[model samples]
Target: MTVAEIKVIAKEMGVKTSNMKKVDLIRAIQRAEGNPICFDTHSRENCGQEICMWRRDCN
Candidate 1:
């Protein structure tokens, strides 16, 4: 997703997104949602969290 869209989601999660990179922002979002800070780390490998919302982007 674009930074703008990520920022919007971060805002809803009360995370400060100013100057945050995409991976960092995604990690923060994952933390807020009680998930692992594993955004973009899939590297095209199969991730165990099959229902992850970031699955497509992570790969």
Candidate 2:
């Protein structure tokens, strides 16, 4: 998703988006949702979260 779209989700979740990069913001959002902070981690290649919404955007 675009940064603008991510920002909207972050705002709704009450996460501070200022000064945070896209990866960081996504990780923060994952944390807020009680999920793992593994948006673009090294383990993405073997990621087990097949149903994760952010999977498509992950590098």
Clashes found in each candidate (C-alpha, N, C closer than 3 A): 0, 0
**Mind giving the per-residue lDDT tens digits that candidate 1 earns over 1-59?**
78789899999999999899988888899999988777887553655787776776785
Q: Considering every candidate listed, which one attains the maximal TM-score? A: 2
Tens-place lDDT per residue, model 2, 23-51, is 99999999999998889887778878999
Pull out the clashing pairs in model 2. Answer: none
Report RMSD (Å) for each prediction in the order shown: 1.7, 1.0
State residue 19's C-alpha deviation in candidate 1, in Å. 0.3
* C-alpha lDDT of all candidate models, in order: 0.83, 0.91
Name the lDDT of candidate 2. 0.91
Q: In model 1, which regions exceed 4 Å deviation?
A: 43-46
Q: What is the TM-score of each candidate against the true structure?
A: 0.81, 0.89
Best by lDDT: 2
